[model samples]
Target: MTENMNDQLDASATFSIELTCPIGLENVLENELHELGLTNTRLGEAQVKLTCDLRGIYLACLWSRVATRVMLPLTHFNMDSADDLYQGVKSIEWSDHLSVHSTIAIDCHGTNKEIRNTQFGALKTKDAIADYFVEKSGQRPNVEKQQPDVRIAVRVKREKVTVSLDLSGDSLHKRGYRQQGGMAPLKENLAAGMLLRAGWSKNSQFSQLVDPMCGSGTFLVEAALISLNIAPGLRRQYWGFKGWKQHDHRLWQQLQDFAKNERVSVDDLTVTFQGTDREQKAIAAARENIKRAGLTGIVEVSLSAFQEHDFSWQGSTPLVIVNPPYGERLGDEMALISLYSQLGYWVTENALGGVCALLTSNDQLARQVPIRPEKHTRILNGGLECRFYLFPVVEGSIKRGDRQQAVMSQGAQMFANRLQKNVKKFKKWLAADKVSCYRVYDADMPEYAVAIDMYDDWAHVQEYQAPKSVDEEKARVRLMEIVTAIPSALNIPETNVVVKHRQRQSGKQQYEKVATSQHEMIVQEHGCDFIVNLKDYLDTGLFLDHRPVRKYIQDNANGVRFLNLFCYTASASVHAGQGGARSTLSVDMSNTYVDWARRNIELNEFSDRDHGVVRADCFEWLRKSTNEFDFIFMDPPTFSNSKKMSNVLDIQRDHVELIDLAMARLSDGGQLVFSNNYRRFVLDSELSERYVVKDITAQTLDPDFQRNNRIHQCWVFQKRG
Candidate 1:
């Protein structure tokens, strides 16, 4: 027989045969094939050209974990049109693959001139096969769309058509373990791919593996199975061999028995797999998936917040994998950034000697994490382009000393360089502007760096860095040195500049410096104290960028009832009340901040019953409040995932609804100032006819924050009566 006929005969009669490997990593797959003793194989793009009989197919399906799908080549032909496709497909010897009564499905994927549409190509191919069987045997197989006995895949690339029998039957990723779905559950195949990319192998020395944001336990289950050397396909009920005419029952049985007998017990291994989530429902889903994977005994699931959970790895370095909620699925970029920042802190502090891989699509938000990822890989998850950032946590005495030295070495120079750059930029910008009273500065340099403004002899500087711990005292001293140097650098008076610090508090004892300042804010603005507390929140009390908004409120607040939702420190309300609003109500949830708002109102001597500060949920208050206002300022938190609140408020998703709600509470021709720091806030077009909205971001932005519009987008919404 010829080479083709002999190969066909070998495939038809033999119980075992070897196959080729996939394209990009043919060498690696070749090594694996050699180890498996399968010598006869070919490699192609995304597919391994392999000649395998039924037994080889069975073994490949059960043992080969890296392959996406295993396909047995049925035929190869060239066709120019649908008619040619039908003629060529009908000529294939279908009897060897499927019987007249058996059901079959055609999955088509193609590129090039002949077969452009995959769906149409699949239909034509199916028609050809069905017509061939009917014309010869007077009977045809039924097409079962969902579960077919035999699945035929047609790939028509570059005018060449190759037909293959899908030996794996179903997608190999469906290892038949997962059942419950949670928020953004990791796909099993993608999870496997990630682990493989992370250099995880059956013999790798991974002591502990964890998925902190595990949704439905995909990674944990896969880790357990891999550690135990369990055949991924053993749990699956059906296989492609059952439908093939040449399937060898005895050989398939032997392969299955071998897989079963060779299965290694992970009990003796030092590896541990665990999953945790903040939601109890997600934890429950994870538990169910673990049990379904027969990994209940091996994998542990817990309902614990990732930021709070203590990761203990028994002195061995651990592998931490996390699929954090991207802002697309989870509302609010700001809240997600804060959460990621906290996650970074937790991982750096606790996972000493561990490695963490974070998957996220938001590059800007990812920068918020303090820990710098040493390696990054691009991957796609559910069509969302994402980057997998790998961070190696340093441990031991050497690591500690290195970290200290690194921080100390960069601390002073970073601050000094940023200060010098900002001073130079500010001077150049101020010289060009006509307004002598205005000031310009770089604020976000060094990420938490602050700069100052000195306009009309009033110095206003916003402190942007938050102190993490007592060790930041060194940074503070360096900041002071920069502050003292700023006057000389900018040719401004030293006595004129004032500083503000911003801090965020989880509770009373859990205070962290969010951002600090050397000389960013003036001691006073228009004779009013502009200094904001920076050591306690994400932002200081005063948003310097919204200076013009405050000015607008101050200019137009006479004889009006003002409502301020999400009134952090009530600076806007103070401006409105001081501008002689007939009545003002500042609504916020934070008692600390509401108290601060009250103090701000008191400072302006507007703290009357008319000028009220209500500490309650803004959504609840908005729904319940009957008081209509002539001027309303609705600037909700850009995004918050607070469990204490009724709903997670996302400005982008809920801006129109918020505007509608504020409009309901607005008097005829009332002015509503809606602001958000979401850099990409796109106003809904539907709101245009009912209200006139103007982009006031340029007008509102303070000179100090001119470099980066971190605080962005303020709009004046006037209801057209």
Candidate 2:
């Protein structure tokens, strides 16, 4: 009888099968296999190995929503070369698996030193299959790429070759009904996994599922498919085993009929699903996919914005699950925080006891929602670390209060006392100098390593970088306490305090934006008006430490032509204009800041005067200028490689050339004020020899900054006439 190979298709035929899924989904995939009756399931890296009968394999291919592929092992052998691979594969009975007329395709992965290219291995395997069929029947099957009748998967790892038949032609996530994928579409299986994680099932207690911001209806469609017991694979027209000679048509037909009988009518289902979007195009795509799945009557899609979603449900309030678009820029997230807060408010007002799950990549923006998440499940979505946050609303919520207490650790009280003491110490200087912005506290306490600068009534607190040896939780507590206690000590509102992470910064890093609240306030310093963007950048436009230097410029600028180089937002120019300089010119490389300088000049009515702002690199602008200045305030960055500059500026290496250029532009007996934050900066010997140099950095420190004179260095170079 030759023990006919056709018997492997029988109900009891057991074979080694492998189910593959994306990383972090192995446990979920294993659980799915267990539900499908796969025996002896063992989890591997991104794969699950199990023993299943032919019927079990069929069921797995037809029902697995999370698996990428179902593979039936054909043969495995030790191999070190392409010839060994061909010989190993040729031994398999090609006639038993494929007919001469059927086409085949090989997908090869992994490699050794000798076979580094996957295509080379695939070609060798394909040659072996074709040669075996030709040797048996004098004709070989043709190789087809798109929708091949038989798909062979080959993996070469650690000098061993594994060859198998891919039972699913394409990745199982491509459930053919997904005809319209919106921007950044979540894969169908991933959507199903999300729903499963959300505890949605045939016996779910929740009566309705609503995706108010649903894009393309993947989540709603997956929910509908799960409730209706419709096999997602049934939408596809072909299976890898259907063309094989060993396939049992009658058994597959029976399995199909069983799956068909398991399908429940939409009217008889306990759960209902609805998807909505503000974009009509997205809604149209959802309808197309729903129609393709033949669930047009079961699932509903509509054009509605989150704002337009009124609490107009018929029965119970649905669990609101949403995936909002997070823009791909720094300041872009600022706008979405209000939108998320609106979402939280909507869920709280409409569904008091219901659940809301939000998926966000930014924790800062999540905090703005004002609804504290009880559960934060970490998931890797397309390699971006994401959190599926679950929040439950209740009356008189105190969970957030508990979280605040927990976050503010034992050192909170000690940090608060340190801030109060610093406020008392700096109180006299703040009023005596008429200073609205000054560093009141700079690391006064060891536990709270933060610097607090006051801009009018607003407090800008910068948390210094903690050491690696310090406990992260302890450091977090210190930061929380510093932010929490600053407003109380300063008599300012909590919202008026701006907190930012402080590290050693230079060049454009200082200009990198943090938030976009546009909380600009005009603060007075020495009777000069300067606009401060407290929420936008690491630095406000006004530098509190440089108060004395700006004061020096203001006190000596009468009837003088003042030049402000590297004029970042032109705070120094504003001081010059306030000091009544006869004419003023401000030059900077950033067009954004040059425009800002223009705005500050307009604020003080300096624009109608002789003062003007120029957008140009100071280095290039100084070289071409024919005008000489009586007072030139040159404050170049430590180093910058901005694309706006033709040459990279390294203050230490280029200070000689920079000094020479500035000295050449100085009028007779004119003083060119050069300053930098480089702690170890040295005055150029040639410039000191050619001109009179006075180190004014010591005298440039205001009473508030007298403790840290190294914050900036100032040297006055006057032309020797």
Q: Pick the candidate with the highest TM-score.
A: 2
lDDT winner: 2
Count of backbone collisions within predicted model 2: 0
List TM-scores for all candidates, in order: 0.58, 0.69
Q: How far does residue 404 in candidate 2 sit from its true spot (Å)?
A: 1.7
Q: What C-alpha RMSD separates each model from the true structure?
A: 14.3, 7.1
The Cα local distance difference test for each model comes to 0.68, 0.78
Q: lDDT tens digits, residues 1-721, model 2?
A: 0112333445667777889876666777787778877757999977899887778878888888888888877777888767888888888877778898999999999999867899999999999998998898999999899888899999999788888889887889999998887777778887777676676766666778888788899888988888888887877787888877657788888888888888887678877787679878788888998898888878887788766756345455466788887645532443344455556666766656667777778875566455667777676677777777777666544234432232333565566667677778877887787777888887866667777888877777777888899997677645655664555556775446667777877566666777666878888878778788887888788778788899899989888899999998888888887888998999998876887888888888876459988888888987999988899998888889887888989999999888888878888978888999888987777777888999898888876677777889999989776
- Model 1, 248-330: lDDT tens per residue? 67888888888998777765667888778988888899998888888777888788887567655565577888888886521
Instruction: Quote the positional error of residue 498 for candidate 1 in Å.
Output: 25
In candidate 1, stretches whose alpha carbon ends up further than 4 angstroms from where it belongs are 1-35, 39-43, 196-199, 265-267, 279-281, 323-721
Q: What is the Cα-based lDDT of residue 213 in candidate 1?
A: 88
Model 2, TM vs. native: 0.69
